[model samples]
Target: MTDTKNEQQWERTISFADGGTRLDKFWGRELADEGVSRGRVKAWIESGLAKVNGRVVDKGKYKLAAGEKTVIGAAEPEAGEGAPDPVRGRLDVLFEDAAMLMVCKPAGLTTHPAPGEPGPTLVNLLLHRWPDIAADKSGMDEQRPGIVHRLDKDTSGVMAVARTEAARLKLSADFAEHNVFKVYLALVHGVPTPAQGTVDAPMGRHPSQKTKMAVVDKGGREARSDYRVLWTGPRGLASLVAVRIHTGRTHQIRVHMAHIGHPLLGDAVYGPRESAEWERRPDLLAGLAPRQMLHAFYLSVFHPETGEPVTRWLPPPEDFCALLAGLPRECLRVGVVGMPGGGKSALMRFLGAMGRPCFSADECVAELYNPGGDGAAMINQRFGGAYTLEDGGVDKPGLFAAMRESDQVRREVNDMVHPMVRHRCEEFFKAHRDEPVAYAEVPLLLEGGWHKEGMVDLVAGVRCPADKRTGELRRLRNLPPEILAVFDSWQWPEKDKLAACDFVADNSAGLDHLEREAERLDAAALAALADRDRATEAWMDGLWPGLAGELDRERAGGEGPA
Candidate 1:
């Protein structure tokens, strides 16, 4: 029979990379094994059910980095491989009694039975030694019998378990609120920017792509992290970072630090390119570190019953030191549609400055029709030298007439120029790998199938009321109103551009204002990045060693001899 009194305990190694996450979320997508979706993950975050390191993280998009030990409500699942037994050797009991028990959990033990996983986990050991402790929490989750928090499989840590239902509820509640404190030791790749500082950025789901966390500007929940540089390594290539989290998010540390261009060495997922960790440090996993160079060392929180601070300490697993020290982890083709002299050039210039790498339709045509540049010689052969400049440049007006009136000529021109333009763009993107954001501002971002390809982020039109636009156009180029109408007819309206752009800046303001707006955007981008890292640090440091030790004990016993 299920015990109505204090019954059950939760502990295990919890890695964000693991199938069942140590982190808890009322609404976010469950880990792959948990069988939840992004929408559900969102629900968890919004409802304040998701948390890391025992603090509320109401955002579904928060992350769980390696070496994180997260304590949550009773609903928290047993993430990762923890069969019920500590290593198949002797057990170390810190405290034991009929009402309760606490143990210094060895790394490498499974907490309970998982599907298709028939091995002795911590639960198996409990059943073998203390038959009366079984309370049957299988109804909550199949894998996790009775759980409060999880340590990663390789993180050695301590844990507490309730012998009765009342004890279980109270313990879970204590962890849910920040009544618990956890600490971790991470052998990171580089020293943190400041000797001691906090990371405070909101966490959110990655956009555009799925299956990861991102430091988002909008639609995220608060995350705070604090860290201090412990010491530089003998070689100075690495350092120890001591961290604490005011809030928890999944993969918070790894993602936040990576966003700032530094990835935890030996971490594959959420890290820099795979080449850095794989090719550069092929011997990493074999030497001193068996797992990632991270360890959860301490956890402290107010004891629910005693109303006093209770702290737990653990040590880094041998595997953590075995790994080699280093690990490295636009635009639519716009066709200009406008009256013959409708400030198209000026508009194009404005769009370009906004960080869009635009490809002007006018420019495309000119380049294509250049001598020896696809249509250059062809234009000369078809139209003669007078129309085609000596330098082999095409006459824009002349070429337009021919292409519009003669489909054959248009086809011929397209045949030569279209392919070349496409190739150039491909090369351009390859070279601009360092740019975080990219865009293209063409007069006709929508005219061609360019924007349809989902390449362009936005369409911005530098426009003014007809009277003002006409006057400006006339001053720039001597074109008649009648001629300009045909040109402008194809041009998209200002309202249309507004609807199309993800964001819009009214260049209608003075030049100084426009510059200010750009600066504002730049500042905002940097600020967001900074805030994200801070928040992640808070979550990272939240990984107290108390739970990590339990996880490490489970993993060592479960896996084959390493």
Candidate 2:
């Protein structure tokens, strides 16, 4: 009876005994297992889904000839005039098979056409691509033919739809039985205590606000949600939470989370637009939100035809990532670097006086070079007392002589000291991880490559003319010009360092000018620490050619369905 073994394809060969069979009547018997009517088969044939001997045959009454091949393309349901108009736009299909398909539903797009959201919905897009999804109308809503479940208009995530009536019934039953897996990511007001917990609440229509759902005590259905705090923003301003729902109800997540007093950020319906948490840094937390911050990050279901498990996961969209970027770090790490005698220490002192925690790399080196210290022992072992003093401390003058004489000596000494300095810096960061701001004065931050690493969030370079730097060193440390040259040779050119820095301060004009520059740099550094606009721009640029483009094309009236 079948010409092909592929389950996705339906083909039959006419036998001499079965000649003169009407196309529709033949298909009606052939697809009786699908429980579809002859009228449906007639529609499929007219739609050019049926072919005779590799040629399309639209007439249902066309008689089959002996030994002629009859093949049917994928079935598509006949659409009614009242049905949604098919709009040919790219759909984000995750997985598709003969019986079902999974797709990523973007936020701000309604799942299907409704009185409130008329036309141009996901269903319309689906119909254009898979007309057969509309084939089985038995007990199906004209507005929502193959849809099994839905995400809120403002909630984006993965969803599954059936391609056939049997598949639809099975999937619907699975969802109703709570056998499906669903996970969501929500940006909420504050971190929930105990880190993880469950919310068991009853939900019903709000008595006062008929348009909203709420946790009601009377005439409500059971709802349960489990959540874990994934990350907390600076100052406990906001938190990213992963939530799993055990029961599906209208606005169950929004209502349950709100009932627990940690409403989702930018949720104006259930959450107050004004709050102390938001008032602290509204721009970073909620002001940038285009809608309530909720994403259906993951979904798992069983295949209707094969009973195989199907799971799909999608990262949050561009806008969600942009909001995530807005969550500020707990501490703003500032790395100060410049040439010798460039007044880096002066800037460090200024920041310290302003109550910022400060760490000095030079001071860390000094401690390491102390008598019986790790640096002293390593130097004594490597050069065999060549750079060691009588008290087991580093002989600074001798070490400088060796460094000036041999390049290998200089590199070995530096290689050993850089990691120690970085370790101390890591310790400093850990100590001040809860602080708002911190400063690290690293003389060779750029030379040692610590600035580019994740050791610091921002780098500030202090620049001074060589002549001016020499005079300052002469006045302060009483160092000669030749020694300054050696220090300068070990570091990058002043201009190059300044070019790589996030911020720069000019110390050539003296302390009053340097102090003014420091003040400006401090303000700018703080702002940079809080700013997430750069990340948002990057995300938007990357998304414009992908998912964002699809939404734009649909809004601009994409081509009609083929």
Candidate 1, residues 1-562, lDDT tens digits: the string is: 1111121222323432442442444223223223455555555556654445434566544555443333332344333332243224455665555544555555566555533335556655655555555434322222333355555444455566555444544555554443455555666666668777777888766775455677878766567666666666422446666566555565666666666555555555666473254445323222344344445565554444655444446545445433322221011222333333434455445546777454555566566776667667666776556458667777877776776667787677666665566555544543342344333334545554555674433333344456755675466677666656655565566677556654444444455655554444444444543554455445335543424554345333533111
lDDT tens string, model 2, 107-151? Answer: 888987654455478888898898776534433445565777788
What is the TM-score (0 to 1) of candidate 2?
Answer: 0.50
Clashes of 1: 104
Residue 534 of candidate 1: its Cα lDDT? 58
Q: Which candidate is the best by lDDT?
A: 2
TM-scores across all candidates?
0.41, 0.50
Q: Give lDDT for model 2.
A: 0.75
lDDT of each: 0.50, 0.75
Off by over 4 Å in 1: 1-92, 95-121, 136-143, 205-211, 272-275, 282-286, 321-562
